[model samples]
Target: MHLNRALQVTAAASSLLLVSGCGLFSDSTASTAGFNPPNIKMQSELGPAEGQVNLIAWAGYVEDGSNDPKVDWVTPFEKETGCQVKAKVAASSDEMVKLMKTGAYDAVSASGDASLRLIAGGEVAPVNTDLIPNYEDVFFGLKKQSWNSVNGKMYGVPHGRGANLLMYNTKEVSPAPLSWSAVFDDASKYKGHVTAYDSPIYIADAALYLRETRPGLHIQNPYALDQQQFDAAVDLLKAQRANVGEYWSDYLKEISAFKSGDTVIGTTWQVIANLAESEGAKVKAVLPQEGATGWSDTWMLSAKAKHPNCAYKWMNWIISPKVNAEVAEYFGEAPSNIKSCDETSDPAFCDTFHATDENYWKDVAFWTTPIEQCLDGRTDVKCVPYAKWVQAWTEIKG
Candidate 1:
C-alpha cells in the first residue's frame, strides 16, 4: 500500500514535470562509467552442452513479434549454439516463484524482490562468470550488485532496470507537483480519479520515503515494518486510499484508465508511459525532486537447472550490446550494457529515456526491497523484516 502510494505520487508529479520541460536528462559521467568495457575472454570455460534452455521471463523480454525479422537478437544465438529455446512468460514475482518450484525452468528474469527469495530458498544457484565468456564484458556496477549477490556469491546476470516513476496526464493537472508531499499530504486536486499499482509488495516504497523524510523516527526496514513504521506507512496509505480511482496490476488497465480520462495521475513505469504515448495519450514519466523507487531485473539460473550449458549460452547471448539494445527498446528501460546503449538505433533514445544520464540517475532513490535487516536506517535496532512486509501486505490487501 505504501508502495502504491509512492507510485501514485510519482506518476502524478512526473506528468506535470515532463510538460514543463523538466523531464529526465542523460547522465554523461554515469553513462560513461556504466559503459566501460568489460575484460573479454576468448572462450567459455564451460563449453556448450547439448540441451534445451527453458526460460521464465516477462512478456516481450524474449522474441515477441515486435522487432524486425533480420534483427531478432536471439536467433543468432540459437543458430550458433544449437540449444533449443522454451520461453514461459510470467507477470509477477509470485508467479515466478511458483513456476520455479516445479524445477522445470532452467533460468528466470527475476526482479530484485524475487532474486533474494530464489537465492534464499535454494531455487537458484551461484553463477560462475568464468563459464560465461561474455561475463567479463558486463559492467562492474551490475556484477557486484547487492540484490544478485549473497555473501560474495553471485546468483544471476543483470538484465535491465528502471525506476517506478511518477507519471500523470499534463492536460488534466496544472502547477506541476514537485514532491511526494503534494500527492500524499494534499491529493484533493485529483480526488477519486487517482490510481496505484495493485501489488502487495509495493509497501517498500513507503519505507523508502520515511528513510529519507523521517530518519529520526527510527523505523526499521520498510518492507519489514515494526509497529511504528508500519503504522506510519499504513496511515499514509489510508489517507491515499480516498484519492485512488482504482488499484491496477495490468498495464493495459492503467493505460486505458489514463487514455479515457478516467484516471489522471498514478504510479507507472517508463514502459507504460511509452505505451500510452504510442496510443495517443499525453502522459509523461517523471522523477520527482524528492526522488523515486525502482527495480532491476536479473537473469538467474535454477538450482536444479537441467540445461546449465544452454542457460549460460543464453545469458552470454542476451547481454551482448546488440541484444541488450533490442531488449531495452522493447521494454522501455535503460539498458545495463553501456555498449548496447551506444549501439541503439535511435540516437536520442538514451537522452529521451534518461538511461545514461547521471543527473537523472542521481535524482532517483532506487528501490531495493528490504531483507532481514531494516532499510529504513534504524541502526540502533533491527525492526520488522521483509518476512513481515510480506505478511502485512496480505493483511493490507485483504
Candidate 2:
C-alpha cells in the first residue's frame, strides 16, 4: 500500500519539489505526508473497561478460537476485563497502516515498518506505560526503541521479536557456513538452489552483507543507505539473482522447497527451521558472523480509539506473563515480557528463542523504515528512503 502510493508520489511530487528548487531526496513525503500527531495527553488514571474493544493485528497475534479452538486468548481476556474483543487480521504492514488510518480500531499489533508510519501519520497515540503493570516486566531491550517512540514518549507495548537467520540444509552445505557470504558471494556454489525472502525489506539483508564485506562502502546502518551504498547493495542482489532458485514470502512454500531439495540455503525465520526439521529436513539456522536482520512487533493504541480504557486493559493483559508466553509460543517469537519465559509450555522455548539474552541481540539489526534523514544521524548526505527501496525491489525481482 505505501509502496504503490509512494511510487506515485515519487513520480508526481518529486517533479513539483524539483521545480520549486526543493531538496527532493532530503525529505520524506510518503506515508507521513501532511501528518503531525497532536500533543494529546495520555490517560493517567484507569477507568471502567468498555464493553467492547476492536483491534487490528497480524494473523497470529490475536486469537479468538476461529482458526483453532485451542488457540484462544480473547475469551479469557474478555472474561477478566469485561471487554469483548473483535479483531481484524492484517496481511501486511501497509494494510495495518491503512486500517489504523480509518480510526475504527482501538489498538493494533504493529511491526516496525508500520509503527513509525502510524506514529508519523498521527494514527496512533502515545502510550503511558506507567499505567500498565505488565510494562514493568517487559524485556528492557524492547522498550523505548526508535520505531515505537518519539522524543522519549512511548507509543506502544512490546509484543515479540524474531530474527531472520541464514538457514541451510546441514547435509548439503559443507563445513557449516557461518556468514551471509554463503548466500551472496558463495551462492553460485549452490546455484539455482538458493532462496531469499520476497520483499523490499530483503534489501536490508543485502545492505547488511555489504556492511560486513565491503568496508569501503561505509555502510553504518543497513536501513540508512545513501545513493551510492544503496546502488552497491542493489547491484549485489542483481548478481545474486543468477544463483537464486526462487524468492519466497510464505513459510510453507519455503518449507516445501527445503523438503523437496529445491532449495539448499537462504534466509529464514526460526519457526521455518523448526517446521522443516520436524518434517525430517536436516536444516540448521545460524545468526551468521555478520549478525542478522530481525523484527520486533508492538501493540499500539489508535489515536481516535472509542474504547481507550478497554484498549489499555487489553495491552496490559496481552503482555502479562502467561498470556505473553502463550502468544509467543504459538506465534514463534521471543516474548517481550521477561516473566513469560517461565510460563512457556515448552521448558526450553525461551532459551531456544533467545528471549532473555540481551547480548545475543547486539548484532541483530531490527527493521525500521529507511527515512531520508539517516537513522545513524548523518545529515551531510541524503539516504535512499523506503519508497526507492520498494521500486528497486520490483526491478530486482524482474
Q: Top model by TM-score, which number?
A: 2
- Give the distance in Å from residue 3's predicted Cα in candidate 1 to where it truly belongs: 39
Q: Write the per-residue lDDT of candidate 2 for residues 192-235, one digit (tens) a residue.
A: 99999988889999999999999999998898899999999999
User: What lDDT tens digits, residue by residue, belong to model 1 across residues 245-351?
Assistant: 88888889999999999998877888898899899998877776667767778898888888888998899788887788888887788777656645566655655
lDDT at residue 175 of model 2 (Cα atoms): 85
Model 2, runs deviating above 4 Å: 1-40
Error of 2 at 286 (Å): 0.6
* Error of model 2, residue 373, in angstroms: 1.4
lDDT of each: 0.70, 0.85
Candidate 2 lDDT score relative to the true structure = 0.85
Local error of candidate 1 at residue 170 (angstroms)? 1.2
